[model samples]
Target: MDSLDLEVLTRARAWLDDGHRVMLATVVRTWGSSPRPPGALLALRDDGRAVGSVSGGCIEDDLIYRLQRDGMPESPQHVSYGVGAEDARRFGLPCGGTMELVLEPLRDAAPLDALLARLAAGELVERRLDIASGRSTLAAAHPEQGTAFDGETLTSVFGPRYRLLLIGAGQLSASLARIAQGLDFAVTICDPREEYREEWNIPGTTLTREMPDDVVTAMRPDARMAVVALTHDPKLDDLALMEALRSPAFYVAALGSRRNNAARRERLREFDLNAEQVAALRGPAGLYIGSRTPGEIAVSIAAELVAVKNGVAAERVLKVATAKAALDIAADTLSACATR
Candidate 1:
């Protein structure tokens, strides 16, 4: 879930506690292009007040208008928009776009409280809502499952925030952590080097004085996790990469030049990592953007990480070195043409 949906839950729970009736709206399906994805949340109060978003703006406005005029429905209901071009224009949906939403009136606090507590505890919970019976239940969400809606029931998975484990406590690590936090990742910086660890101070990320490899072992990185080696020291980055590359981390990368990363892979093969496992390492990490500053480097890396996390094809990604070289040649040709 994104931060928007989490904010919706927080706001909805507050309204429920204040004796205000709240309606929870979830985007369960979308056709063509959508401003938000499935599982996007919106919490609407009995009054016109609201939090979160289902569409860009117009959809929320229409929802608020409906609630204000027609009042909250007694049971869960289904609402859709953009069936026609006129409706699409009115709701600000993109041309040919459509959305299906599940609106559930909330009066009970027990389930909400339980769901919030479970999420806070870092547990993945599946929220099941039966449309006909207007009943809801929570269960442990499986690792590979995602939000699903059939004709009868809606299953929304709420889990702990995705995590990014950085095997360094330096300027690049700090920059990357800051950016990753914005993307709603629970970030951790691990460094056994006392000097580096002592000098580090980032607000949201956890700075641990543990061995990088040990930290990776403890994390038990799953598919939702990312492990990045940034320290550049073999003693620190190598073992961590060895563990991470073998694990199920969605993105496992190291900060190094092309030559160094290649050498690192060869070294990892000596440590019993197979050719395929070492091949999984994304070194010279981040897109090729000719980044010189730490912050720029972080942005380039974070962009690539986001692409991989979204399952973008590697072939389509723009590598910095190649891209920069190509652009430089183009600029030179343009300069020659202008001179002539």
Candidate 2:
């Protein structure tokens, strides 16, 4: 679930508490090229105000216009948009796109409060709503579960969808954390060095002064998690890599030059990790973007991480080491010709 949806729920609860009628809308399904995915949320108040999005903007406008003219529904109702070409154009949906939404009139905010509390406690929750009665229930959810609708009930997964453990507290890490958060990743920065730990002031990130290896072990990285080592200190980066590579983390990477990464791999092999685990380490992390500055490098690394998370084919991505080596060979050829 997106953090923005949480904001919608928060605002909805607040509006209800303030004696205003609130209508919560959830996109239950989408057919083709939709701007927002299923489980996206929008909250509408009685006074034709909204807090989220369904389509681009026209859909929200229509909803607001309906609310002012028709008032809130007595129970949950299913509303759809873009069933025909004319409707698609009118609602600003892409050609042939269709989306179904469930709009529930808010009579109580207890469920929203409960859901938000679970999310704050870092627990994955599934909110189930009955379309007929406008009643809902919350339950513990597994990480693999996603939003599902069976025509009568809507089950939406909400909580942190992805986690990122960054083993550094430097400028590059700061930039990466901001990007990751924007990508809906819960970020944690770990650095034992007092000098580096003291300087980390990035908001919306958990800073830890514990050893990187210990932090990695505690995180027990799963498939939805990524572990990145950016401190460039072998004692720190190598230790974290040894543990992260052994876990199911979808992306385990370290920041370094190609030569440094090669050496780091050799050092990792000396640990308890097997050959395959050592091979899993992505050194010189990021795509071949020719990035030089800290911010550019962070973007490159974030791009690669997203690619890996999305299951992009390896052959489709150009690694930094591969591209840099090719560039080096081309430079050497040019130098030899000049000398000739």
Best by lDDT: 2
For candidate 2, write residues 1-340 as lDDT tens digits.
Answer: 8778878989999998889999988899999888899999999999988898877888888889989889999998888999999999898787777999988899787888898899887788889999888889999998788888888998999988899999989999999999998787889999999999999998778999999999999988899999999988888988888889989999999999999999998898788889888888888999989899999999999999999989999999999999999999999999999999
Q: What overall lDDT, based on C-alpha atoms, would model 2 receive against the true structure? A: 0.90
TM-score of each: 0.86, 0.92
Q: Write the per-residue lDDT of candidate 1 for residues 225-340, one digit (tens) a residue.
A: 99999988999999999999889999999998777888998899999888899889888888987799999999999999999989899789996645756898999999999999
> Clashing pairs in model 1?
288-320
**Residue 105 miss distance in model 1 (angstroms):** 1.6
Best by TM-score: 2
Off by over 4 Å in 2: 336-340
* Global CA lDDT computed for model 1: 0.88
